[model samples]
Target: MMTDLVLIEQFDSRTAAEVARSILEANDIPVTFEADDAGEMIPHLAPVRLMVGSADEAEAREILSEAMKSTDEAGEEGVDGEPTA
Candidate 1:
């Protein structure tokens, strides 16, 4: 019975926002996905906002940032120390 009402972070791509939303939800934090339909109408418009609750806002952003960092690190790594192909 929790509600999502905090604007935690914004991303240019829906994919990234979705990934962030998933991370917050997985961590037991309530999340709401707000798609930028306006951006869809105009690709140059503002990015989409990934919001959560006020109480969990800070924690959610930290979780998302950490997740993003881990993803970046993983992408930088490769099997046998070889670059990704």
Candidate 2:
């Protein structure tokens, strides 16, 4: 049986999208990456789309949200190559 895939996120870099895909997959959420960059000959030529089954969208988003939220928090705390006060 085939399931409907929904675009849940997009990233300018494939590496970021790969990280998102890894997170979703690790959570047991089905996901795929969509991009048209001449078969990755030029990955930055287009944004990478992170897709999940329509049924999995919410869970996938929540997982990603939590992950990104932590990243944002770290940045706010000055963890990106900077010392935190």
lDDT of 2 by residue, 1-85 (tens): 2189899999988889989988888998878888988888997888999898899888888999999998887776664667676
Candidate 1 per-residue lDDT, tens place, 1-85, comes to 4474878788887777777777888999888767756757764466778777788888887887798898888888696767786
Error of model 2, residue 40, in angstroms: 2.1
Error of 1 at 15 (Å): 1.9
User: Can you tell me which runs of candidate 1 are displaced by over 4 Å?
Assistant: 1-4, 38-44, 83-85
Note the Cα lDDT for every prediction shown. 0.78, 0.86
Q: After superposition, how far is residue 40 of candidate 1 from its true place, in Å?
A: 4.6
Cα RMSD of predicted structure 2: 2.7
Clashing pairs in 2: none
